[model samples]
Target chain A: MAETRTRGRAPTDPPASFVWTRRIVLTLLAVFTLVPVYAMVSSSLKPLEDVQGKFRWIPSEPTIRPYIDMWSTVPLARYFVNSVIVAGGATLASVVIAIGAAYAVSRYRFAGRRVFTVTVLSTQMFPGILFLLPLFLIFVNVGNATGLALYGSRGALILTYLTFSLPFSIWMLAGYFESIPRELDEAARVDGCGPVGALLRVIVPASLPGIVAVTVYAFMTAWGEVLFASVMTNDQTRTLAIGLQGYSTQHEVYWNQVMAASLVVSIPVVAGFLLLQRFLVAGLTAGSVK
Target chain B: MTSAKVSAAGAARAEGAAAAHGAGPGGSTGGRRRRRLPGKALPYLLLAPAVAAELIVHVVPIAVGIWMSFKELTLFYIREWSKAPGKGLGNYRVAVDVDGAIGADLLRSFLVTLAVTVLAVGLSWLLGTTAAVLMQERFRGRGPLRAIFLVPYALPVYTAVMTWAFMFQRDNGMVNHVLADQLHVTGGDRPFWLIGNNSFWALVTVIVWRSWPFAFLVLMAGLQNISRDLYEASALDGAGVWRQIRHITLPALRPINQVLVLVLFLWTFNDFNTPFVLFGKAAPAGGDLISVHIYHASFVTWNFGTGSAMSVLLLLFLLLVTAAYLLVTSRRRPAHG
Candidate 1:
C-alpha cells in the first residue's frame, strides 16, 4: 500500500544506461521463475521417447500421446472426482464451523477462552502424520464395529484433510474477526437482532475477504495434500496426488503421462489462485500477522 | 457508550429482579433467569460445533494415535476383529534404534529432513531479506516484481511440482539442457540431475525454489513494516548499508525470522510431495526420506504396524529437533509473550 508514493525512480537516481541493465537483470530473475514451469509444459507435450531421449529445447517430434495416454491409461478422472468431492466438502464444512467459532472467540470473553485459544494454537504444532497410526486404528475399529470400514475409504481421507484445514481456518478467521469493529456487531444487536442474526447480517458479510482466503487455503491443502491422501485412501478411492504416484510401476515409469496428469490436477488450484491473487496475498499476510 | 448502555440495561434488569425478591417471594424467577442464561449461553452454543469438530477430528485422532503408539497396532489384525497384541516399546525399539533391520533409512530420513529444513530456511532468509531490501527501494516495477515473485507460492502443488520435475529430469531435462547448451559446460550432452547422489541436491533445489517465495512474502512484509526514517537517520550518521542491516533490520525482524525458520523447518521436515513427486516412486534406491519411507512401509508392504511405528519415531525426532531449536533460540533471547 505504501508503494504508491515510490512508483518511479527519480531522474537524479542513477545513470540512464543502467536502466536497461536493471531491466535485463529483472527479466533474468523472472525467467528463473518461469523456466521450470515451461519445461513441465514442454515435457508433458512430448512423447515418452522424446522425453527420455537426447536433450532438445523443443521436442523433436512433439505429440499429444502423453495427454491422450494420461486419461486412457490412468484412473485420473476418478481421482479428480474424488479430490473434488473430498476437498470441496471439507472446505465448506470447515469454513462454516470456523466462521461460527471465530465470531464467538473474537466477539466475546468467557471462561476457558484462553484455554480454547491455546489449544487451537497448539494443534498446529503436531505434524498430521503423527496421527496416521492412531487414526488408522480408530478407523479400522469403527469399520469393524459398524460394518462400514472407513480405512482406505473416501470418508477417511475427508476426515484426515480436516485436521489441517479446520485448525488453520479457525486461527485465521479469529484474527480477521477480531479486527472488525465491535461497534458494528453492537449496532446490529441494538437493531433488534440476536447474536446469530447479527453475525449473519453483519459480521459474515463484512469479513468476506478473510473467509475467502481461509476457503482457498483449506481447498488447496485438501486438494493438493499428498501425505494424508496417499496414506488414508488406496487404489479404489485414490486422489490425484496418489494417482500421480501410480504413473510409475515396477518396470517402466511413464514420465510424460505423469507430468500430464500432474498438470491436469494442478490447473484448477493455479487458476483459482490467479483469479483471487489480490485477495490471496492480502488474506495470507493478515492471517500470518496479528 | 454501547457497552455502557448494555451493561446499564443489564444492571437495571438485575436490580429490578433483586427488588422484586426484596419486595416479596411472589414474582416468578424462572422466566427472568432463563433470559439471562440464554443471553450468556448463545455465544458458547455457536462455538460448540467448532469445538466438537476439533475434538472429534483432531484431538481424538491424536489421542488414539498416541495410545496406539504405545501399543503394537495393526490394521490387518484389527480387520480380523482380534484384540491388539500389546507390544510395549517394541515398535519404538525397532523404529528408533533401527535394530539392524531395514538398514538406516529412518536415521537417514531424519538427517535429510533436518538438512533440508536448515538449508531451505537459511537460504530463503538470506535471499528473501536481500530481495525485500532491494524491493523496498524507490525503484520502478517494484510492485510487479513483488506480485510475480509470489507465483510459486500461489502455484498448486501438482503444477509447480510437474514443472520442477520437468526441469530436473535426468535426461533431456530443461535445466541440464540449458547447462549443456547455452552454458556450454557439457559439450551438448545432457547432464543427469536426478540420479545417484545428485537426487539429494535436486530435491533440495526444487524444495528451495518452490518454498523461498513463501519466505520472500513474509520477509518483504516484515521489511516494509520497518520505518524508513531509521534507515535515513542511520545513513546520515555514517552507518554503512551492511552495518545498518545488522543493527536495524536484523534485530527488528528477529521475531518473524524465528517464526519463519520454525515454520519452514516443520513444514519441510513433514513435506512429502516435493521429494516424492520430483523423484517419482522408489527414490533412487538410497534417497528415501522419512515421509517417503512411511509411504513405502504402509502402502508398499501393506504393513500398517511398521508404518505406525515409523510415524511415531518420526514424530519423536521432529519433537526433539523442534525442542532443541526452541531451547537454543529461546536461550539467545528471553521468551516473547
Candidate 2:
C-alpha cells in the first residue's frame, strides 16, 4: 500500500501544510494522556498540603515525605512481599503447566483433542465473580476439613489466582506452539532424540518468546487483581491489590496514600509491559484471535 | 563446542557399530516397533494440572454455588459443627423475591451494575472507536501520541479511583473547582459528589475515562489490520468517508467489536474497586453495584448463604446476557451457510 501510494506522490502522505497542525494535535494528545500519570507521580512526591486542589503541574517543593509516611503508617512492604509471592508463584506454575498442555494439544493428534481445546476456550466465558463465594466456601471448608487453614492465607490467594491465569496461559501457549513447525521436532527425533527430549531441547527453546509473554500476562493479572485477593486473604496475607483497599476507612478514604501506593504498585507492571511489549503484543494479538 | 566434539566421537563409534552390525545381522533376533498411539494418555498427563486447577478453583465453585443456592447456611451455623441444612428454593427465594433488606439490596445492586455496564461500555465504545479511526491517520508525533493514550490503562485502578475521589472532593476538588470557576456551575454550595445520586454518575465517568483506552487499543489494532486497498478503492469510487467506513471498515470490525463489547460489559458489571473506595460503607446507601453488595454480604454482614445466592444469580444473569449476545451475533453472520 505504501509503495503504491508513493508511486506518483511525494514521500509525505499528507500535504506539507498540515505538518504543524499534526504536531499541535500530537502534543495536545500526549499531554492529555500524560497528565493523570504526571499528577500521580508528582502527588506521590508532594506533601499533603501540596496535593490540595490548587496544586500546580509541578510541585513547588518536591518531597518524598509521603513515601516515608506511608511506609511507617501502612504495611506497604508486607503487601509488596505478598503480591510478589502470589504473582511469582502463580506465573511460574501456570507457565510450566501451560507449556506442557499447550505442546500436547498443538502437536499430538489425540482423541478428544477438539473437545479439550473447546473446553479450554469455553472456560473463558464463565463469570469470574460467581466463583468467588463458592471458592471462598471451598477454601473455608478445606481449611477446616484438612486442618491446613487455607482461608485468609497466601496459599489460598495463590491457588485462587491460578484459576484465572491457567485458562489464558493454556490458550495463548497453545497458539504459540501450534505456530511452530512440527518438522523441527521430527528432525530432532530422527537425530536420536525422543519426544520428551525433542520437546525440551527444541520446542521449548523455540517458544521462549510466547512463554515470556504468558509469564508477564500472568504476573500482571495476578498482581493487579483485587477480587479473589480481597476475598481470600486478610490484612496479614493481603496483597498490594487488597492492601490498596485500606485507603478507605468505614467513613472516609485517604486518596493521597492510595494514589501513592497505586503508583508504587504499578511501577513493575508498566516497566514489564514496556520492556517486553514487542513480544507481548505479538503473542497476545497472534494468539487471541484467528 | 564441547557437545560437537562428543558428537564427533559418538558418530565414529556409531559408524563402526553400523558396519559390524550389518555383517552380523543374519544371526540377530527380529523384533518390530509398533506405532505409538496418539491417545496414549500422554495428553491427559500434561493437561492434568490446568484441568485439575480449573476444576477445583472454577468448576467446583460453580457446582458448589449451585448447591448452595438450594440450601441455607451461615457463618454462625457453620462454626457450630453443623451441616448446611437443606432448604430447597429458600435461599433463592430470599435472594430474588424478599422485600425487606436482602432482596431490595440485591435488586438495587443488579440495577446499578446494569447501568454502569451500559454507560461504561456504550460510552467507551463510542469514544474509543472514534479515537482509533481518527488516530489511525498519518500524523507527526503519532507514535508518542499513541503511547500517551495508554496512560489511563497503565495507571493502577486503586490510584485512578483515588484520584477520582480527590477530583470529586466537595470543596477543593479540581473537577468541582473547574466547574465553578470556568463553567460557573455547582451542584450546590458545597457539593458532596459521593453523597447522593451524583456519586453514581461520578463513578461512571471515572470508569469510562479509565476504561476507554482498553477499547481504544483493541479498536486501533483492529483498524490497523484493515487493508488500505479497500479504503482506497471505496474512496476512488467517490464514496464519502462515512460511506467508506460504513461499507468497508464496519463489516471487517464487527467480530472484534462484538467480542470487546461483551467482555467489557461483563468486566464493568463485576468491577468492585471504584465503588468500594469512593463510597465505603456509604456504597449501599448511595447505590452499591452487585459486586460491592456481594462483598458486603459475605464480609461485612457475614451472610455467606445470601452472598453465595447473590453470586449465583449474578452468574445466571451473565450467562443469559452472554447467551443473548451469542444468539444475536450468530444471527448477524451473512445469511448463506
Candidate 3:
C-alpha cells in the first residue's frame, strides 16, 4: 500500500497539461458530487415559495424557518427520538452479541465452527426483503397466539435490524479478533484471568477500533433502514426514515421541511462516518478486499 | 510467516493428539484436568445468542415465507395464515402465468429489474474504476477529492434519495431548471423526471450516483494491494497507460471486482428504497423493479400468497447467482481457507 504512493511520478514533475487535466477532472467530479448536497442545504434554507418557484443556486432569503417548523409541523421530534432509541438499542445489542460470537470463532476451536462461519456468511446472501412477508406473518401470528404484540413495536424493528446487521458485525469483528495475537489472550489467562475475563480486559481493549467499526455499522444499519421500518412501525414508533415520508403525500409536498429534516436525520450518521471512516472502511472490506 | 504456519499446524496436531489420547483410559493428567472443566462448552455458549437470534428472525421466517407461498394467504386469512388452505403451486402459477392479472406485471418487473441492475452496476463499475484509477496518480488535493467522492455513499439512503427526489421534481426540479432554463439543452420542453417513462432514468441516475462510491472505495483498496512495481515494470516496457491498466490493473483487481459486481447486482436488484421513496406505492410502468412490485402486491393489494411466491422465486434466483458467483471465485482461489 505504501508503495502505491510512490508509483505515480517517480519523484519527477509531470507535464503541465497532465497536471491541468487532472485538476480539471477532479474539480468536475467534485462539483458533480456536491451539487445535490448543495441543493439540499440551500433549498432547506429557502422559503416555501422560492423552493417551488425559480432555480436559485443560493437562497436569496435564507432563513432557518424550515428547521424551526420541522418539529412543530409533524412528529419529527418524536421520530428522531424513536430512531435514537431503536438505533442505539440495536447497536448496543448487536455489538455485545457479535463480540461474544466473534471471540469464540476467532479464539477457540469448537464443533461446527466451520458451519458457524458459513452460516454467518450465508445470512448476507439473502435479501432483507425476502424475509419481510414471513416475518410479518410470524409477528402477527405470535401476537395473536401468545398475546405478545411484536408488530408496530420498536423491539420488532430492533430485532429485524439485527437480522440485517449481526452477520456483518460478527464477520468484521471476528476478522479484527483474528488479527490480534493469541499470545495476548494466553498471557491474560495465565495471570488469573478466565476465558471471559481475558476477553473483556485484553481482547476488548485491543480491538477497540473493530468494536467501534461494528457499533457504527450496526447503528447506521438501524438508522437508515426503511423497508422494514415502513412495514413494521406505526405512528407512535415511526423511525426517521419512515417519518421523512410524511413530507410527501397525495395532497401536498413539503419540500423545504423535508430537506431540513433530511439533514437533521443525516447529521449523526454522517458525522459518525467522518470520524470513524478508517475503521468503517476496514469493516466494510473485511474479507472481500484481501 | 512460514514459522507461524508451522507452529499453527503443530498446535492443531497437538490438540488433535490430546483429544485422541483423552478418549483412551490412560490419558495424561493435564489432559484429564483440561477435560474436567466445562470450558469446552464455552464457545457454543458464546455463540448461542447469535445463532438463536438468526434462526428466529431470519431462518424461521424464511421457512415460514416459503410455506406461506403454497397457501392462499391474503388479507382475509392473514390472521390465520398458519391455517390457510394450501394452494399447491396455485400462487406460483398466478405469479408466472402470463395471462393472469399479476403475471404480466411480474414478468415486466423482472425485465425492468434486470435492465436496471445491469445498467446501474455496469455504469457504476465503469465510473468507479475510472475514478479510482485516476486517484491512484499522485495529485494535489487528492485526499479531499477522495473524501468528496465518498459523500454520496456516506449520506443516509433516505436523505440522498429525498434530495434526488426534490431535484427530480417535474415542474420546479433543479434538473429541469438546469437543462431547460440555464443550459437550453431541452429547448423549453422540460422532461418529467419523476413520472412516466423518464422515471426509469431518474431512478437509475439516483442509484448510480449512490452506488458508484462503494465501487470506488472497494477498487481503491484493491488498487493499494497491487504491487506498484508491476506498473513501473510495464511502463518501462513502453506500455501506455491504457495497456498497463488493461493488463496489470484489471487482472489484479479482478477478485475485488467479481465480489463487487455480484454484491452490486444483488443490491440493485433488491433495492426498494429508491423506487419506493421516489415513486410512492406504485412505481411508474417504466421503473417498476421487482422488489417494489412484490411490496405493492403484498402490502397494497393484500395478496400475501402471491407476493410470497414471487419473493420465493426471487430468492431462488439470487441463491443461484450467489452460488455461481462463489463457485467461480472460489475456484480461482483454491487455497482460500
Candidate 4:
C-alpha cells in the first residue's frame, strides 16, 4: 500500500482534485470525533469553578488539583482495583476459553457445531436488561441454596460479565481462527504435536494479532460495563462504571474531578489500545493474507 | 529453530511407535483413527467449557427470565420469587394492552427507541463507511486522524457519556457555547439539552459518537479483504469514485454490513447505559429508551412480573426481527457464518 501510494499515478488512481476532498472530509470527521474527547480532557485539567462556568477552549487557570482531589472524592483507588480485577479476570478467562472453542469451530466439524455456533450468535440478540432481573434472582437463589456469597461480590461481577464477553469472544476468535490456514497447524500435528501442542506452537504464533484483537475487545467491553455493575455491586465491590457516580452528591457535583478520574481511568485502556492497535487492525483484516 | 525441528522429527517417530503399540490397548481409538473421523471427540472437548459457560450465563438466565415472566412477582414477593403466584401471562396481557397506561408508556418508549436506533445506526454506518473509504487512501496525517476517530470507542462508556453530559450542560457546556455564544445559532438562549425534547438528540449524538468508530473499525477491516484489482478494473472502465464505491465497495462489503447493521441495531436498541447515565433517575419522555423504561418498570417500581413479561416480549420481538433479517438477507446472498 505504501508502494502503491508512492508509485506513479495512473488512470486507476483517483483524480488529483479528490485529494483535497479527502483531506477536508478527514479533517471534518476528525474534529467531529474529537469534540467529546476535548471536553473530557479540558474539563479534567480545570478546577471545579472553571468547569461550572462557561466552556473554555483553553483553561483560564489550569491546575492538577482535580487529579489530586478525585481520589479522595470517590475512593477512586478501590474502584479502580475492583474494575481491574473483575474486567481482567473476565478478559483472561474469556480469551483462553475462546481460543480453544474458536480453534475447534474453525478447524474440526463436530456433531453439534451448528447448534453451538447458532446458540452463541443468537445470544448476542438478548439484551442484558431483559435478563438483568432474572439473573439477579438466579444469583440470589444460588446464594440462598448453596451458601455462596454472590451479591456485592467481585467474583459475581466477573461471572456476570462473562455472559457479555464470551459469546463475542467465541464468535470473533472463531472468525480469526477461520482466516488462518489449516495447513500450518496440520504441519505441527504431523511434526509430533498434539492438538493443544499445535495450537500453542503454530496457531498461536500465527494468529497473535487476531488474539490480541480479541483480548483487547473483551477487556474493553468488560471495562466499560455499567448496567450489571450498578445492580450486582455494593459500595465495597463497586467498579469504576458505577463508582464514578460518587462524583455527584445531593447538593454538589465535582465535574472537574469526575473528568479527571475519567481520564485517569481511560489512559491505560487507551494506551493499551493505541499500542496494540496495529496488531488489532492486522487481526481484523487478516483474512486475505494467504 | 533448527534443533527444535530436528528433535521434533525424532520425537514424531518415537510417538508414532508408541501410538501403534498403545492403539491395541486403546481399542476404541483405532476405528475412529482408521476412518479419519476429523477429531470428533477433540472438537467437543475444546468446546465444552465455553458451551457450558454460555449455558449457565446466557441460556439459563433466559429460561429463568421466561419463568419469571409468568409469575405475578412484585415487591412483596421478590424474596420468594420462585413461590410467587402464577399469573399465567397476565403480565404479558398488561404489557400488550396499548391503550392501558403501562402498555402505552411502553409503546411510546419502544417508538422512541426505534427512532433513535434508525437514525443513529443509519448515520453511524454512513459516517463510518465514508471515513473508512477515505482512510483507505494513504495520505499525510492519516495515521493520527485514524487514531483520533477511535478515541471515543476506546474511552470507557461511563466516562464518555459523562463527558457528554457535561458538554450538554445547559448553562456552561461546550455544546451551548458553540451553538449559542460562539455561533449565535440558538438566539443566545442556552436551551436545556438534558431535559425536554432536545434530550433525544443529545442521546443520539452521544450514541453516534461512541458507536460510529466501531462501525468504522469493522468496516475498515472488511474493506481490506476487497481485492484492489476490482477497484482498478472498475476505474479502468471509467467508473468514478462514487460509482466505484457503490458498485464495488458497498457490494463487496455486503457480508460485513449485514452482520454489522444487525449488531449495531442490537447495541443501539438495547443500550441502557447511554440513557441511564445521561439522564439521571428517569429519561425524559422524549428520550425514554425502552431498556431504561423496562429497568424502571422492574427494579424501580419493584414490579418484577411486569418487567420480566415486557422483557420476554422484547426478546421475542428481537428474535423475530433477527430471524426475519437473516432470512431476508440470506435469501439475497448466502449467510457467511
Compared with the true structure, all predictions reach lDDT values of 0.66, 0.68, 0.78, 0.79
Candidate 3, overall lDDT? 0.78
Give chain B TM-scores in order. Answer: 0.80, 0.82, 0.85, 0.85
What does candidate 3 score on TM? Answer: 0.90
lDDT of 3 by residue, B1-337 (tens): 0111111212222232333444654433334333222389899999998998889887888898889899999788999875789999999999999987789899999999999889999999988898887777765567777888988877878899999999988777899999999999998898988788898899889888888887887788778777767867777787766667689888878766766787777788888888888888899988898889999999998889999999999999988887787688758864331
The docking category that best describes candidate 4 is acceptable
Give the Å shift of residue A149 in candidate 3: 1.8
Model 3: per-residue Cα lDDT over A31-128, one tens digit each: 87899999889999998887878667888799999999888777888999999999898889889999999899777766787677666556555666
Question: Which numbered prediction scores highest in DockQ against the true structure?
Answer: 3
Recovered native contacts in candidate 2, as a fraction? 0.31
Order the numbered candidates by TM-score, best leading. Answer: 3, 4, 2, 1
TM-score of chain A, model number 1: 0.87
DockQ of each: 0.34, 0.33, 0.43, 0.42
Model 2, span A76-113: residue lDDT tens: 89988998999898878878888888878666656675
On TM-score, who's better, 1 or 2?
2
**Candidate 4 chain B lDDT trough over 10 residues, lowest sum:** B1-10
Which pairs clash in model 4?
A: none
**Runs of candidate 1 exceeding 4 Å displacement:** A1-29, A47-49, A60-69, A249-257, A284-289, B1-38, B74-76, B80-82, B180-195, B235-246, B334-337
Per-candidate Cα RMSD to the true structure, in Å, reads: 9.5, 10.8, 6.8, 8.4
Q: Tell me how candidate 2 scores on lDDT.
A: 0.68
Candidate 1: tens digits of C-alpha lDDT, residues B1-337: 0011111212222222233434554333334432222377767887787777667666887766655555645545656424667777776676667556653667777777777667876776666666665555566577677776766766666557766766676565677767776798878667566677777777777777777777676676666567777877776787765666679978888766766677676667777777777776567543466677777766676656666777766777777876798678768977543
